[model samples]
Target: IAEQFVNTDLGGQLGDWLDFMKVMTLSSDRKAAQPDLENQRLAVQVMTIHQSKGLQFPIVILPFLQSGSFPSSLKKHPIINRLPSSWMNWEQDTETTFRDIHNREERRVFYVGVTRAERELYLFGPTSRQSMFTKELESENPQPMEIKTMNEHQDNSLSLSERKQRLLADLNREIAAKQIDNARNILDELEKADRGETADGSTPKSTSREMLHLSATKIETYDTCPLKYRLKHIDNVSERKTRATLEFGSIMHAVLEEFHGLKIAEQTEENLKYLLNKNWREDAFEYRLRGEEFRKQGEEILSDYFRFIQENPPNVLKRESPFSYVMDEINVKISGKIDRIDQDGDTLAIVDYKTSKKKEKAETNLQMALYTEAILRDAVPGVKGNPGKANLHFLRHGDDPLSSHQFSEQNLQDSRIKISKVADGIRSGSFEPDKNEFNCRYCDYKD
Candidate 1:
């Protein structure tokens, strides 16, 4: 109000009037005051409607029930409007008008607030300009009282003893009610404990809750932003619809998996093109023109990759190999899929496909180290040795894209320690967000 007063450039006369009003409000019956329950320190809880969700109170007061205040005017979604009806399954997923969606969400929030009162609910606003919701309720044939005047009291004010007595009576009633609720809650908890059940009425697991297996992808996500990892993994929050780049990567990986499954002689340019066309995502691209551009790029990339492979064919040992490595010392299990493994002389070479524009360094990359360690620990069949080399095969790079790194003992150990720290942090529920502006800009769970 003070800021608004300044912004509105209200003069000294208006300021003096505001000061008088403030004083009048403070002395009024509706003056803000906490309950005087010292022993229990009980007081009326004040919170937003959102915070009151799924919680029932004896009495709930909803203020600012005016139409403009409660159900504010709808905001436009410019991006959604500009998007194609079929792009990213928008129509199929929503199947409703944007205004309707907004109204439904607002209604749900209002319903939650209303239902939070177990016994009594009070709604305050200008009777002349009531909320649209009040009209909706009226349509249901509910009775509403319109008060014009209160019955004249014999005394305008109460004496000190009379006020004290009234306050004491109200306080005692509240205290008794609170005591009964607390006792009931205690009894319920004791009963659940005796039955060997959790507070949620489910049987408790014997194993430690901290025992969790993590994927290389999960560890990398946690390293980048712990909150993102928790929201996606622990809370099972759905990520934003896959962008063209991610969908492209997925489709490319699928095509390569099928292409490499065949013998070297069977892997020809014609066959590669066939596989690419077969596995191409039609709906992944936001625009048809962009899609065509990507398709042309994919064809060229596949052609170049096919030529490179034909010139120097790798001794493919296993393709799309799944492996799991358990570090018993830290009680951390690492699981991931290696894109390809090759028999490079005496030791095995771990190859992970990368579809991104940027190249990842194998030495410092925890994902590469994890795959190498797993293979070295005999996680993959017929492969039991240290990391001869780890290569990040960037599919975006048509010719000579393999970034290889031979990990020393210290590098591997450092990677392991880092992995352990990530595991410990996740187990301890330490999901603090990394507030890096660059990362947060593209983060789906930034909120």
Candidate 2:
């Protein structure tokens, strides 16, 4: 392309084109990512399965086909809850047993990964710890090209925790040997032994009597998946993958808090942007480029929020307000952070900023009712007369419209009853794993 421009004999035109291209490239601030695709380039190539979807290769090697490496744990899929489960048509090898949608997708991707190699294909993983396709591979009786460790036949008596650790260690060593391609990820996992906790950074004590404080989230986790709650709160297990969205939401909340905390004189666009930069997090995003994009997206969301405020600014009385109350009915403490409290005429409105694209089911929103009850009884500073309304500000939407949930005596009472029941259920110490699978992977427990 440069040669074509040079051959045009337009003297300064080629130089102008080069300068323009340079500016365009630099404006994005994204570093060089793609490798030279030319076959004669004589450089080792690497690409993710999704990236190589329609592309073919002369020789392809797929690493880490062990369980949880490809299909991932079914207990928590980012896209699973986007739509209702009934709409999905289950795929299966034999029609009798319904297949997991995520497992089916993984199988299809594995096929694609293998078929890409027209000449030769290689797969690397621990032979004893194969993923979903392990049973089929064993039935076929295929031989492995290499064995990294001596524990070819794992002992049956080994504890589940022990087995998990061994497998994790093996995967890491294997990854390190494979040109240390994923060493950073491995290191991050290894460094997680001391991390993963509740928002307050408290780990669950083995003694039930020690746990005097139980938040709404804690109760919700137990109700949704008991084993998950045990692993996360009780045992404290380490998470395998980074929760980008969770971190993204946290950063957004911090920025919003800062935006509200500022005085009117200090609430300029530049100052707001500075607060965003101060609260900006790069660790949550998958890559630096994505982090940059997220920061920019955050700024845009904030701008939209600011515009909304200009049009219809409610009297914000509190920012990132904390409220803790003991549910005397259940004898458990339910606490949560109310994003904002605003005075709407005669009553106070509890507002929460929902960063997610999906609106949380209004009926299932126990926090709103819980906060309202606290405000009405406790006489929270913002509530002038009666504690009534709650607002969910969805920042992602184009118009930044508010979703309001009005408080009714019956519904509030019902919410209290539900909370009490859930609290009692948890206090009973019965934790059943979700039918799909154990949600240990996504849990904050890292024992």
Clashing pairs in 1: none
Per-residue alpha-carbon lDDT of model 1 for 291-349, expressed as tens digits? 78889888877887887787878888888888887888888888888888888888888
lDDT of 2 by residue, 1-447 (tens): 343333332332335667756865787775756655667325556788888888877788888777667656556556744555444565743333224666787788887787788787777765333555543445555555654432325433222343234435544455646846466654455445333322244433332433347766776777778767766665544344445667788988998788788887776778878888898755455444556777877888888887888778768788887777776544677677788888888888888888888776454577777778778677354444577578878888749457778888888888777776666556656556665435444444322
Instruction: Count clashing residue pairs in model 1.
Output: 0
Q: Top model by lDDT, which number? A: 1
lDDT of each: 0.71, 0.65
lDDT, residue 30, candidate 2: 56
Could you give me the TM-score of model 1 versus the true structure? 0.53
